[model samples]
Target: MNQKAPEVHPSSEWVQRIFDRISGRYDLLNDCLSLGIHRLWKRAAIRALGPVQGKHILDAATGTGDLAIRLAKVGAQVTGVDFSGNMLIRARSRAPASLGVQFVQADVLKLPFKDHHFDSTVVSFGVRNFEDPKRGIEELWRVTRPGGRLVILEFGGWMSFKGFTQWMARSARLLGADPEAYAHLIESSCSFPSGVGFVRRFLENLAEVKTQSSRKIFFGVAHLYVLNK
Candidate 1:
């Protein structure tokens, strides 16, 4: 018999603590885990945004401001929001004043923006961490302008080499990173819905949104989902 997937309802406080604890070495951890290919995945997500020049965009869960800074560099006015204060601190430091990227410390489930305020909204690898991913998506859609797109980049499915990934998580302590935090991340990705399942359960059932496209990257290691409001 097939096993049931684990539920992924991480509390807000727990999520905040995990991210804050890992913030200092968050970028390094990503580079180590994904072998730096995450940069390319992010680039693909940006490309899916299509013609962001002068557009007002919101980058939800803008860890270390990687996607936010890149969007700003390409002429989009970007506001990056995250609940972890430490993560936002690093994000602010990494973003140049010239790029004009604003980093805000806020919860994704309760965004501090006016309705229909952003031309487009994007979240990279952040949705799964939400205590309520469905409500988080609703908040993203609430801030997006009519006809604006909501782009989400996330781990598409389970990583192939479970043993190796577990080992990496264990070894994270050697690099002064929290192994439990990395383990939680790996666990969440394994449980969260991906690809068609994600769309059907999250996007398709939402009356106010339309699923524009869903693209799998790196043989379904990650997915880029585009939705229009």
Candidate 2:
């Protein structure tokens, strides 16, 4: 919710540029599109982190550093890693001065850090964009300390709300999102890892896993996964 503005959706090559274009307009669009309920979803994701003081936190795919800032606010020493240079630039420019947060431009598939380096890791609405989510999940697990936590926030499918799906699609289209984009949103969620599937994936690699999902303001889907290494 506190993430910096977003850019117009763009291809992988234009990742940085796309985020930059939407950076200034990002926050407003999010609130407008989701009716300000994203704040609650973010809060829920952060809550799953429990207490974080003095812990080292990694905010992977930290677009605009919103989760990093939130982690810092809770007394964690936060490091934000992202692939988009412009996104990092905007994060650096807008982040709170005294939060003790650092930003790094790095690929999630190959994080430039030692194994088991962080106490906790987080990614909000960032995994869907990964070229290889399994590799991305592995990278998160790799950098995380044993017994540490990894929390991810992403979209959930609309299957549970079939009656309202059409209305929701129309609503998104009216809110400045391209119809194709909204359709892609629906399709991606349909194929994305479900709550149980995600837990199964975690069971294969992580120590303990817990999950919770919600609909944000009748406009967006939010899924939170907490994995302890």
Candidate 3:
């Protein structure tokens, strides 16, 4: 029997509610589901930023501010934005004031920032949640300064590994995540483009944008894409 698929792009309000609901356990669940490999992937994404010290950077969809906190600790003036107020609360609590990281409640699609305002911008595992990913990417590009890079770390296509989405859903449930929230995550990842497909479909048409590199992480469970403007 064929089963119905989960919604790949849920409403913005739904996205906000799910993230807020899971905000408390979000980081832990990520550790459990990815077996802590996500930490390594994040480190790789940071390295691709290429000397962020003292640079102004934007960490869009910075849930819990993990990447933003890391960037700030490394001397970059970082601003992390997310639409979930609960998530922002946790992010603010987790981030030390001395780190110079600020958490804001804002939408990625409609960032409250001026054009060419950031030295660099990054989105880790957040693009898929955007109702319009291409527009999201364009927004990220809009804020990045000329000659700066846009770094994105996202899941690879799930088709290569049969039953991977099922495993993720089951594991997330076991790890105490809301079932529907994780279902949205699984469905979005399964539907979103990655690596070359992402570059070709979403990024190639952007003016003055150059694909720096696209590499798979951990046997294609995730991918890192770096683009220079």
Better of 1 and 2 by lDDT: 1
lDDT of 3: 0.87
TM-score of 2: 0.76
Q: Write the per-residue lDDT of candidate 2 for residues 1-229, one digit (tens) a residue.
A: 2233223223444444445555555565557655787678778878887788999989998887877887788898999998887778878887888997999988888899999999988888777666667678888888988778888877665433665566556666666654444454455555566566755653355434443333332344667777766
lDDT of 1 by residue, 83-116 (tens): 9999999999999899989888999999989999
- Runs of candidate 3 with Cα error greater than 4 angstroms are 1-6, 158-160
Instruction: Give the residue spans of candidate 1 off by over 4 A.
Output: 1-7, 160-164
The CA lDDT at 185 in model 2 is 43
Q: Write the per-residue lDDT of candidate 3 for residues 38-106, one digit (tens) a residue.
A: 899999999999999999999999999999998998999999999999999999999999998977799
TM-score of 1: 0.93
